[model samples]
Target: MAILTNARMPVETVNFHLWQPCNMKCRFCFATFRDVRGTVLPEGHLPRRDAERVVTLLADAGFTKITFAGGEPLLCPWIIDLIRLAKGLGLTTALVTNGSLIDSGTIRDLRGILDWVTVSVDSVRSGTLALIGRMTAARAADERHYLDLCDRLKDAGLRLKINTVVTAANHLEDLTGFIVAARPERWKIFEVLPVQGQNSGKVEPLLVTPGQFARFVARSRSVEAYGIRVVPEDNDAMIGSYAMVDPAGRFFDAIGNGYTYSEPILRVGVRQAVSQVTVSRRKFLARGGLY
Candidate 1:
């Protein structure tokens, strides 16, 4: 049975994957955008004015918050300009990055307008990160590097979020100690997901059983006492819960197995474009997408 929605959609948040190139190649990344990378947009992203237009369209569409993510958003040269413009438009801005490019300079650039910085830290161990392809170099201070990033963001008065995807490689590793030390405002623990068009075949080795994912969640409970909201998202909880956009500025949704994309919002306009895919505000809330 199909669920019908009202025409009046109150979009609270949207994740804008503005860039398609990344420095670090994680094995389980679902936002690779490899399919549309060179073919869809020649520059790997929308041109400057078009990029700003997309953000403007989103703000005018009344989205409360917009999360800037990418293959690695920091790699995009003009992303700060977009972030600053989004803030000026009255939309709460957030960034999801692998944390490699973030430095004192980047932090200084985002100090006032950027509300949250969510870093993807699956494991502090270099060997495991190598297996998962999260990071290439075996830096001696890997643990210290990430933990320090938490402190730096917090010190800048920007909210911190740590996203740990429990995979076969790090499912057994207890990240509670790290979580306690870093002390982020929110710790989002996601079971390694396999999206068809995104990471179907590539995600198989990284996938964990539900029980294994459960075990990881159980051990992570200790962080709640430290005022960290540990939110676990299994596959079911993640489906159809987010309003996500691709690098070419089109709305996309995760269907039964593969992804279904809308006509580019730039071409079709916001309402027609968003209507091409189904989004559940009810599901979004249940998944704790807000805050």
Candidate 2:
């Protein structure tokens, strides 16, 4: 197939999802999952081939930056190999993960391959934890462990971006405290996206509307004061990154949705995928969106 990615808008960033299911069933996540069956890794569904094709596609599409994301990217088993491949291609690679996967081995493997890592930290206490559907039976220790990992990562000279998905369930009174607590070099804030399907009804009332989200942004300026660069999701400078690809070799739209193509690009080759990405991006941009 001859895919044509001939768009005028400078494509700069690309994001890929290593897996669809996540360990922490966060209330606001839209990514599909297999929570009911309690199987995080479905049978016969590994993304190796797809990720390989994605690297080639992004490289051809003029993408210099790439991000690997998932319900939890670290769960992909061969995440280190994927990062190495992306780095070998001269692409700055990033991992968007839940901090639960942080460990000495993971950190050691990422030492040179990854350019930046972003981990989700919703709240300080267990109450807020339940709000996100990730709870602690007793007093939680995972938060402390994650913080320690963050410190270690920083100490190892890795760039860290803390991702906070703001929802009504968050401790609004101590919102600033939460961001400051992470002490990340870069902090990215997001309006809680309502997750639909089996997890929908339980989380609907917790979401902040667009108007309320704007108000929250107005109130949380402490990230800047703390010397952390706050990258709000809606900012033009924070808009469409250099390039974004999915585990299935599908390019992502500016706001992180998959490209509108008839088939999964992973089934094809790099050149064809790039052509499709270019075509999809041009169509997406001309349509006009908050992204």
Q: Identify the candidate with maximal TM-score.
A: 1
lDDT of 2: 0.62
TM-scores for every predicted model: 0.95, 0.77
Choose the strongest candidate by lDDT: 1
Against the unseen true structure, what C-alpha lDDT does each candidate score?
A: 0.86, 0.62
- C-alpha RMSD for every candidate: 2.0, 5.3
> Cα deviation in Å at residue 213, candidate 1?
0.6
Query: Please, what are the lDDT tens digits per residue for candidate 1 over residues 1-291?
Result: 113346444458989999988887788998888877747776678887998999999887768799999989999999899999999999999999998888999999999989999999999887888888887454323788998889999999999999999999999998899999999989999988898767877789999999999999999998899899999999888878888899999988877667778899899877778878878778788878887
Q: Mind giving the per-residue lDDT tens digits that candidate 2 earns over 173-209?
A: 4556656776787776777654334346656767776
